[model samples]
Target: MSPTTPHQPVLLRLLHSAIALLVFGSLLTGFMVYDRYDKRFGTLNLPIVPNTQGIHGTIALTFLILLPIFAVYCFHIGDRRLVQSQSMQQLGQQLTEVGKPIWWVSLQRLTNTFMLIAATLAVVTGRMMQEIWLPTGELNHIWYIGHLISWIIMAIGIALHLLMSTKVGGLPLLLSIYHWRIRESDLPKNWLKGFKIKPNSSIALIIEFVVIGGIALAFLLPLFVTA
Candidate 1:
């Protein structure tokens, strides 16, 4: 494929699209829920929606469900696109003046990692939340606070992600993630054909396990805890 006609794995596109759409849906419905019930800061001039909380919760659950699989892909299959051990060193070198795509690529990798981490935070906190907590006038819960902050972080992260992508790979790279036509090399069967841990991939594996473990605990903890 040519530079402008960039190619991406079909799986990556599906995961990316699903996660992005679900996340934005969650954000919208979440805000509506907040606007309807917990308006500590301010309120929008929108009509109250009775099922906003339910809608938000559903979207969040869906996002959480797909998160682990996507995490695995990022940590292993797409590790090259994430922040590397020398990412800071690379970013540090070009902090003063912008010169090459190298620095921007490093920044983009770091942003991708951050987005994953931040999304995990959102998921865990959201799962920990009670559907009735906000509606019942209890807004100071730690999990709710974390989820709220995560929403803001995700909004900012999205902007940085876009800026970094545009800076590093330009329009072709930006469009690559959305490109539907997959190359023969991107076939799903080819992904796992002889797939094995790369040298020094232990760190990625560890991090992936940690995130997945946290997600599992988030869902399982509520079962053991009282309310």
Candidate 2:
């Protein structure tokens, strides 16, 4: 009789799904919360969703709590593969054999790391502004500045990550996160095995542009109109 093989770890798949849902939901909810608190910014013009602040704030807080847990899980995965090694030689050796091309290097990883850092800062500042830290109005300016700056930095970091991923085969990487049927052979050996190479999807690109444009109009137009 043949021995049964163990099931592949579902943690990665779960993490990917959780992160996607949390981040996307958090962003949408954040928009609603901002609109409610600062109605001077004008409505988001989203289809039928009105006054989403309550929902958004609840989700954002939940996401904020979940992010660190996800981070720990991801680090565990990396550690199992020796991707988080302290030795430079081990790191270089691992990088050389990563699933993606050589062009996708430490800099790309660094960008991702920085993006997470910036996102954490944004969340922290946002919480402070929402009075999670202290009396809300007491430190409004400082918290607002921190939130805005961190948000801008995170946006830039996300943009760069997307561009670089596209430049060196990010389509498959993104798709793999969404599509569960992808075979193990079709993916990087591990989280740190690197991203997959594939052409960018036009549909995804268009959706991103539309969403960003809507967000910009919602947040920026009011400033000029009120001025």
Candidate 3:
């Protein structure tokens, strides 16, 4: 009999869906915002979007709100899917050699880690931006540039992520993340009882806290600043 494909945990799937939806939504609206306001690179033939900045900001804000939870889960419960201590060493191995499986797995882990880093950069820099900066023709702000670069990186990272996943696990593995079936132990009600969330490594714990804390600070900074 053929082996059943492994399924991702329900929490990861839900968070992933929410974050991915908002990321793409933000990216689309962000392009519209750029098209309507700044065209330093070049302009698309698109028409002006009404309040595109507002729509982009709203989508990005929703992504920010959900990001911390997802970061925590990936760092803790799903750390295996992220780059490990020996990831570099694994990468040093030849793909055509004996460690082909480990090399590919390590590459996938690195891609996931890269995407998470890109997402965080996009979110934090985005939070630092003033909506008026673009519309007022003040487009050279460091934060805005950072945000745009991060957006590009995240878009590329997402593409690489999908490509690597297909390379490693094929269609079934790609579809596993969207599966709706839930295991009993992974149910939300069983969380506290099971303490299912445990950091796989101290570095992951630190990275998770730093990401969540940094994002939390980004939101609170504007509330206190008089300028």
Candidate 4:
């Protein structure tokens, strides 16, 4: 790909960074909240971090404020180049070939759209629970259930997005978020020439293991310590 606008690249990098932090931190805190409040499931306990309620609520609100800004930036400047990118086009073609019903597309889009909205709601409700601003409710079971359901759906959407991205060289796109210094030679010479990146399989595996293990350990540590 040819060099993109400097401002746009910088903005994309910032948005990506913020989103990554929010997602990881919020997921960790969510597990903590589950462990503390919903202990019926024996496997749910984890002590990777303490004081999770406050930490999670804070991060959620921070992300809530950041999302609209990122969304607007994405709409105004980001999505066009991203959608037109060779990787994304290939990914779309693969999805189309999957031969799922039209409802699948509709459902995916609906779930994704509402997942963002639901995340916002979860953040707001979490803040209310924290008394950081004002109480929205009494923190009843229904509200907690809604928050958990929304989070699960959002996580599912994220997983789907990751799976689909792999078809379109997802690792490179992910790397581009952090490593922006692509050589000019790496660019596609023509539409016929494909874009490719060096495969660092060991690094990839380490990252995968760390993330999956971190989440699992976050849940199990508390139980082992207690035992």
| Winning model by lDDT | 3
Where model 1 places Cα greater than 4 Å from the true spot, the runs are 1-3, 94-99, 198-206
Best-matching candidate per TM-score: 1
Better of 1 and 4 by lDDT: 1
lDDT of 2 by residue, 1-227 (tens): 11322233445666657766776776666655554454444676544365464566666667666666555543334322212222223335555565444435444554555565665666665665543322233334676667657766876887877775455445665444455554564355544453323212343234324433433343455445531
**Candidate number with the higher lDDT (3 or 4):** 3
What TM-score against the true fold does each predicted structure earn?
0.90, 0.56, 0.88, 0.56
Each model's total of backbone clashes: 0, 0, 0, 0
The better-scoring model by TM-score among 1 and 2 is 1
Q: What's the distance in Å from true for residue 6, model 4? A: 14
Better of 3 and 4 by TM-score: 3
| Order of candidate numbers by TM-score, starting with the best | 1, 3, 4, 2
Worst 10 residues of 4 by lDDT: 191-200
Question: Weakest 10 consecutive residues, lDDT, candidate 2?
Answer: 79-88
| Tens-digit lDDT string for candidate 1 (177-226) | 88888678778777654344662355556666667787787678778865
| Model 2 Cα RMSD, 1 decimal | 14.1
Which residue pairs overlap in candidate 4's backbone? Answer: none
Q: What TM-score does structure 4 among the candidates reach?
A: 0.56
lDDT of 3 by residue, 105-220 (tens): 88899899888888888887888888779878989988899989999999999899998888888877888888888788668875434234656666566666767777776678
TM for candidate 3 is: 0.88
